[model samples]
Target: MQFTDEDLGAWVARQRWYAGKSHVPRFRILDVQPAPGATRYLLMDDAGAVPALYNVPLALVDAPSEGDAVVSRTADGYLIDAARHAAFAVGMLAEMGVDVGRVTGSRVLSGEQSNTSIVFEEDGHPTIILKLFRTLHHGENPDVTVQRALSDAGSPYVPRFLGSLDAEWPDSGRESGVARGTLGFAQDFLPGVKDGWAVALDAAGERRDFTDAARDLGTALAGVHAALGASLGTVDAGPEQVASTGLTWRRRLATAAAEVPAVADRLSAIDAVYQAALERPWPQLQRIHGDLHLGQVLAVQDGGWRVVDFEGEPLRPMPERAIPDLPPRD
Candidate 1:
């Protein structure tokens, strides 16, 4: 059975992870990959300034459940958002080729800004979290590889990487007319943990000394950097890389000036500093959490610190995200 792009356009716009929310999407179904109990739809959305691809997995049921909306009527069942069902988690595990015991339960995490993540349960207890990538690309997702590397290294700074799913599809842009990309990833769920940002905020609000916590966080970050360097290795910042990075500085200055006219007044002063930085010696760059911040760290009670989301800037191209970078969080 097949469905049209129009079947998903309106529904996609309502999704939290949809980028072009302002405009109704023009969806074009690219490929359909049948999983255990779901069908993964690869779509190209042409409603934005540029065409964007997305991965949407769906399932059909006999009747609409609590939050299910009947996308269409079919003789067998009604098409619904498969990610909301437990079977979707089963299919997701099947898709990722992982065996984390029989999935006893499944629930979507709230306040997801990008990908659709579902917490899966085993033996009637929650355990694994699978993130379905909303935006599609044709390459290795660093979020999987970097974390996987650290996890394999027995690093305590990150959760254990369960597995990841990837698929190949037609793409005329590539020389082979085919491309491969990650679909989703599953990781062990860290239960009863708090974000460093919240803890810091509370400490600040209460006027409590946070030196110990801050030191622990710095240690954890250093451990993460060390693990990444050992796993991925580092390279000297060559002339070309430095020049490219300097160009990025100028670009940032331009953006800052444009965004705040007041910043334009001090543009020359900023440029002078940037010029000085360009002429200075540069350190070896390595794989890093390109988008690191306080919010990305977790404070595990009785534990040190744990970092998550190794994938670089979400806005950067996938391949670029995999590149070795400065720890300064570009």
Candidate 2:
């Protein structure tokens, strides 16, 4: 089945994860590849001032009534979101080397912005979650790289990294099939777990003692950090790196001031603080999770905490996200 850029642009604008949601997109197809039981598209768009790339996986069916996952109907076939297609979900697990006896049910998990997650359950096999990255990068995704490294280091603070799927394409200025991008990530899903944010909020609402849980979470974070540092060595920030970091802070503040005029009043004060911080010795930089919050963690049944989502800040560039940076800026 074939689809046009116009069709994709309109559908992408309505998606919550599209960066250029407020404006109409002008898309250019970069590459098309065959996935397990679906088709994958790499699209570039100049929707805003800058150009962006995205990955769209589609499942084609002869008729709309064939599946409940239909996304749109075209002259060629009925386009369905691959994440919502049962056959595609099972095939994705197999591509990741999961030995699930058989997929009994599959559904797309909601409340996500940048990617689509599908949950697969079987009678005897462990439940699996597949995260399909929406935005496309030229190289390995940090979410997959970091998690795999941590899992390999025997860290108990992360879910088991089963495997991942990637595709190669011919990008401009590169040799044929030189550019590779991550398609999806597979991991073990822990059932009966509660998000740390929800647990904390519930505890606060009930006025329950959460000190023990907080301490355990801190330990888990420290353990993950240790594992990452061991796997990917740390580097001492040189003077030049420190200066660059300070410049980034100023640039961010300037952008914020331009977007929200109210920030103008405190601009000077913020700059003063940044200048003072520059005078102090910089801390050693390592590949720590760039964005860590209560919501990025889960509390398991045994009173243990597990960190998830190593994608970093959604606004940061892919290169920066993969490198060693300062600890999450609270």
Candidate 3:
């Protein structure tokens, strides 16, 4: 079944994962590939200031599907989100080279903004959480590679990396007009647990001292940093790198000033601070969790802190996010 411009574009425009919500989605199918139980589509949207590429895995079914998973109904039948389809649940694991027989049950994990995740159970316990990247990029995903490196370095702060599914497709953003990158990743599922932020909130509500837990969180963070530095190594910021960083800061300030009038007045002052910082001695840059906040971490019961979601800033384009960055930004 083929999606018309109206149906597909309208559907994409309505998605929470769609970054260009303000602009009407102008989608063009860049490429399509047939995979087990689904057809994977590489869609491009030029409506936004920055063109975005989307990874859309779809399944055509004869019957209607429940909820938002249903994209549209056609004469051919219904086009549904393959992630919700039973066969797709089994098929994606096959793509990751896992045996389907071992998966006792599978269900979608909700409240995610950027990706779709399916929790696969084994022996009646959720064991693996497979996350499919909603946006397409042209290189390896740091969430997979970085976490795998940490796991290999025997870092206890990260979940055990299982495997990843990657693919190659045409991308105008790439100089070669084609690129290869991870499509999804499967990792050990850390069951229901409150994140540090949530734990802190509870502590505050109960008027309890969280000093020890906060200290432990800091220790865990430092350990992860050490593990990454040992595994990925680090490099001193060169003159060119420092200059580039300053340029980025200025660009971000300009953007903020443009969007918010209040920031416009302080733009020059902010620029001066950026210049001052650039002149100071620089710290070694290494691979770190680019986007590290309280929400990105989980406080497992009696298991210490287990950091997750290493995908970097969700707003930044893919290739740029995968680059080594200053660890202090975490």
Top lDDT prediction, candidate number: 3
* Cα lDDT tens digits for candidate 3, 229-266: 88989888999888887887788889999999999988
Candidate 1 lDDT over 1-330, as tens digits, reads: 556778776677777898887776788888888865778888888777867888887888888888664566667778887788667767778667788467777888888888988898777777888888888888878889898999999999898998998898889889999999888898888888889889999999999999999998888888999999899999999999889888877887898899998999999999899889878998889999988888888988677888998778876767777778787552
From the highest TM-score down, the ranking of the candidates is 1, 2, 3
- Which pairs of residues collide in model 3? none
Report the lDDT of model 1 for residue 176: 97
Error of 2 at 133 (Å): 0.6
| Segments of candidate 3 deviating more than 4 angstroms | 65-68, 172-177, 257-275
lDDT of 2 by residue, 137-164 (tens): 8788999998999999999999999899
Question: Per model, how many backbone clashes are there?
Answer: 0, 0, 0
Candidate topping TM-score: 1
lDDT of 2: 0.83
Please state the error at residue 228 of candidate 2 in Å.
0.9
Off by over 4 Å in 1: 22-24, 73-75
Off by over 4 Å in 2: 65-67, 124-126, 173-178, 260-263, 328-330
